[model samples]
Target: MAGTSKPAVYKYSRGAQPGTAARTGDWRFLTPNWIYRPSPCRIACPLGSEIPAWLEAVKRERFDEAWRILRRSNPFPAISGAVCFHPCTENCNRGQLDESIAIPELERAVGEWRQKHYRPPAGPPVTRGRVAVIGSGPAGLSCAYYLNRAGIGVTVFERAPVCGGLLALGIPQYRLPRALLSRELEMLKDDGIIFETGVAAGGELPLDRLNEEYDLLFLAVGAQKERPLNIPGAEAAGVISAYEFLRRVNLGETVRLVEPVIVVGGGNAAVDAARVALLQEGITRVSLVYRRTRKEMPATADEVDAAEKEGVQLYFNLSPQALRLEEERPAEILFEQTETAEGKIKVLPAPPRSFACGTLIYALGQQPDWEALGRLSRELTLFAGGDLVSGPSTVPAAIQAGRLAAAGIMERLKRRPGTGEAQFLEGKPVVGFEELNLAALPSAHLTRRLSDPVAEAGRCIGCGTCSSCGLCALYCPDLAVQWRRERYDVNLDYCKGCGLCARECPARALVMKGGWEDAC
Candidate 1:
């Protein structure tokens, strides 16, 4: 008994060898295919930013990692945070639970935090052939940013004295401060992007001449030309296009205005013009006139609300008829009552109502200056994007266009036929409110004031992605699920496909897949 080790008494009976399934038919059922799906927010973004990835990084207190993830797709998060329509929030899966995540505010926080703390070390000189981008707006800047990062030399040409085409000239300072905009633009300068202000490509500089100097030409010339108002008294001294007025104001020129300013149209430009008019010293009682109802207005609801809060009177369903002039300035404007019936605008044939105004600003819309682009050169590789191609879209869309143009240029210059679509594993099903076990989650209504990053990051549900919570491992029926490094993996030999691991997963990141043979 002393030498035999007491026959190693067993406490429990053992089953067939633990890993024996590797050689038998049981392997088919035990094998599982893991997948990673794009969050709804990521799919909605035209820039293809990995929203969930960065959010997870933020939750882990990896602020720099989050910023790096953001920089992978969006070049100007600070600018976008101020101006982007933020379609990502609308598409967020969290909306089904309580409220959509405050994506734009968080993005702004990350951008501001990164700007204050992280400055990328200067990159080496570009060895790839020189690329010329015309226009210093979102599209051109985005294109140049990506190209420069890729070691491609980029020279941005602008006709204005300053950069940021619409960003500098079209947007109001109250919405996007010029100092913040300039600081964001300085990042471009620090990255070694060549700037040729007061130089107009395709016209003053000549596209043919540029072709000899640069290997590629990207025409990002955005739509800055104001769409003319066809109504009477458009040429009146007091009536000015909103684009021109905003441009003059943004460029730091003195705009002498009279009281009772009237802004026409129902777009962001109109709302912006109204707000700016309210801030002017001589202006009082700003009125916004639109033919459509509040619900149909093109401007963002928040912007409209801001304008109203700033004492701008909104007159919906009012169509401009004629402008009465006194001493070559607008004195009064005639309007007609309008209503939408069967999806068509019907102007009622009633006695025209008249409203008096000291000044009039028409914020109708804008179109690209095709003449600036001139005729397309047959001999040169030409790429056009941004508002020039999309016709006055949102800033994010314009940025996306620039990214696409950069990709095209990269493909052409590299002489690659085309890179195939990126391969990705299928993601798990989107987690719904009903599927979530709320007991383990933070309050669905949990949100922070936009300034608080830690509190805001806490509200994230980590939808459709693993938060590495270890709940799956804790609940695995057969001890098949194990944590290694930072991720959980299944030991298929011990797995019986009971699906408890996936069922208990808090983030809905795991899914029970049919075996390889069964899938076939």
Candidate 2:
């Protein structure tokens, strides 16, 4: 014991000592900053919905708050939830781990919740500006909703007897239920948005009257002019465009279909037409012929799968040459076998083959009828969006266009010169899976339409969003991270520029920047 120098006693400083008293933040070239970057799902979403925020609310069982947050950007969540391709799910960071968080299902749950519990708000008085929206498609309705919410007097003119253009006339009831669409439209009406049905913009109501009557005009006349089937006998009595066919079917018109129905093209409309034909009475066989293979199909994989499941036969790499007609109706169709090479379709050298066809529906696509808009004077303030501007796009893209047009109109009304585009996430960096701390997250697989929405929502790791999990504070070796004023704050006086907090952050909300100056 005498020689052992009994355990050297080291006095502990109560607070900072010598070197620790100095601002350690100044000692390093890099600093940790809290910043919000667009998640890959948010970036890929055309409507730009704040998905993580609403998902957080959903997981917490705050359904009302989630619905409110969702409706801020998207007006018709119910409709979009059912019909949107849900590109957000495909780009979800969680998918890199195990499975995507079933975004569309959660979105639909939120939407359906709103539909069940929705109460009409007191109509906001029309106090700002007057806007005339031509067409009642997603774009037109979205523009009208935003404008009305801004206290602008908005009137939607629809050529169809019903208000919803594509929703009512293009998409079948199986995808977007008519009852849901009607309820959503009723809610919009109760909020004081006016809808005038059976009024054609360029036909009955002239563009000149709209320009003179309203402060601004928003045109969302969706792409309605079908691209014709240029083949011989395309004008046969049994041959029809897919748009016309779907429109007639959706409008409750009696559709008489013959057996061995053939639908040409590789898009959603083509698939819809074939499926609809299969459902018709007296129709046993419905075949879909596409010039390209299934991999090259523009239709969503789910729809294609559903078509196959519903007994619609699919024939790929067949290009229709001509329809052989009997009594001015399609009897047999001749096709040229083809192959895709370097993104181009090359006809095979084999002899042309023919298939018996009782009817032919061509879903080649549609174009915007711009004849009336061409006559309007450029002097008038006109904002055009949706399929009218970008032909044959998805519902969410059309909604985005409408939102942008509304913003532009609002700017013009406020006498400010600006493009109508939403600039919030323009320059923000999109967060990738590599930037996330996946090690901190547990692996889980969420199925679509899971009975427990909360459980499904809980799977989301809140990529690129701060959840204030206190991991930063917990992992900081220097005790420099502090939770203050509802957010995490770093005490630069004690922070030594260590990257531990950033590395421990599960949300990728904290990043180490190159300079001591805050880059957030």
Candidate 3:
């Protein structure tokens, strides 16, 4: 009878009773199996800032704690919150549902809130160490902040007429307010970070001397030199470098330009300069000329859109070939129309010409003068992109580089030695983000906050780099998300290589490994 007993055949209809979509194994404890330890968003950030912790503080209105958490990665949250271009938002799990969370706004809120309410305790009088920083840009100011916090005195020297080398002069005020800049500088001063404005740290001021005086020296002199407009007779009276132009305008230069201005190049500088020129000339016909199409233009989309909306004309597929001079005065601007060839835009010979009344502002771009930097280029270090020659150029990138530089300096001092291990970077697999149980995370239906479409112009200038669609946080009925935060701090911890978070993020912001596709 046992042998004859019919082997039961359970039919699995498309919906035949599914086994309780079994609780994904708990790996956080790492008992029977390994648990993923990383917070997805933090993993996405370049600096690995404890995002979840600070964001949790922001959510709970613990502004001071949040500010402190942000300070751990970026000491200049106020500066970054304003202009750093929120890459975190691009990776936000909420972006899939609607728009991404207004991370910059949240950051700005916490930053401003902290600025108003909290204050760092002042350290005792300057002790043994002094860090001489060449510039007061984000890199320099940030380095000074960290060193000063560590009880090491920092003296920042700035060649610029003002304190912020790029932050004060290059960035437009509408984006990053001067008031906010001044406030952050004040905070640094209170924290024992000294700034010597108008002092050049180059040969005149002596870089060698700084190396001799301070225990450490950080060169952050930003790329100040501008690329000359290389058109015929570009040195004609009307041509000007975009850097000096923007700097002057931001510094309250009541600059009055001749009517019908033509701005060469389609970068941030070009857009800002053209828009400002329009504001000064009052709709006197400003044109942004770029050889490449708008897609390839280096200006942030917001910048380009704002310029267009503000009535700046755009001339794509055009490059100025020659600037006609007559009687020692410019007569006309000749441009060669461009056409895409072999996946690259190239200017054609003998092309269309446009007549203009006056000035040409070239924003083609700028770079660090290697000759000017000389051996310091070896020290300050810059790439063709004007970022530090090494590491990522973004805010988080600078954070990562600064941290590594600190480690290198520490090693040189024989404080902590490197392991001599080769850091060969190879991508590996991790958790299932979106595959989690959705019932746990309190109303997964609720969406993340975002910039209002109507108010997009005045606010919402984003760097556009997110993908976060939250499933892992919502699933794991055992409250795994909270546990992850508690154990490894979901802030910026590395994962236990589980696929849960990867499965849960609908945005596919995370990926996993070991041949476990979505099967896990």
Candidate 1, residues 126-218, lDDT tens digits: the string is: 656789998999999988887877678899999898999999999998778777788877877777888899888755778677879889999
Scanning candidate 3 in windows of ten residues, the lowest lDDT window is 457-466
The candidate with the higher TM-score, 1 or 3, is 1
Candidate 3 lDDT, 1-520, residue by residue in tens: 3787898887765675544344443233331112323344455666666555566555545677777777777666677778865666677544543455566777777678767875767547666466677777777776666666555667888887788767888888887899888998898887777888877756557766765677666766666778887778888786778888889988888766666788888778788888878878455688888888888887878779989998898888888888877665566787888977666877677547775747778886667756765655344322121154542245446545554554455554444422331122225332223543333333345444444311221121111111122344445344334344232123212224454654554333334444222221
Q: Candidate 3: TM-score?
A: 0.75
Worst 10 residues of 1 by lDDT: 416-425
Off by over 4 Å in 2: 1-32, 372-379, 415-423, 442-449, 468-470, 473-499, 512-520
lDDT of each: 0.78, 0.85, 0.62
Better of 1 and 2 by TM-score: 1
Candidate 2 lDDT over residue span 354-409, tens digit each: 98999899999889977856766676678999999999999999988888888889
**Candidate no. 2 TM-score:** 0.87
- Candidate 1 stretches with Cα past 4 Å from truth are 1-28, 31-34, 120-123, 375-378, 415-449, 477-485, 491-496, 516-520
Q: What are the models' TM-scores?
A: 0.88, 0.87, 0.75
Tell me the number of clashing residue pairs for each predicted model: 2, 0, 38
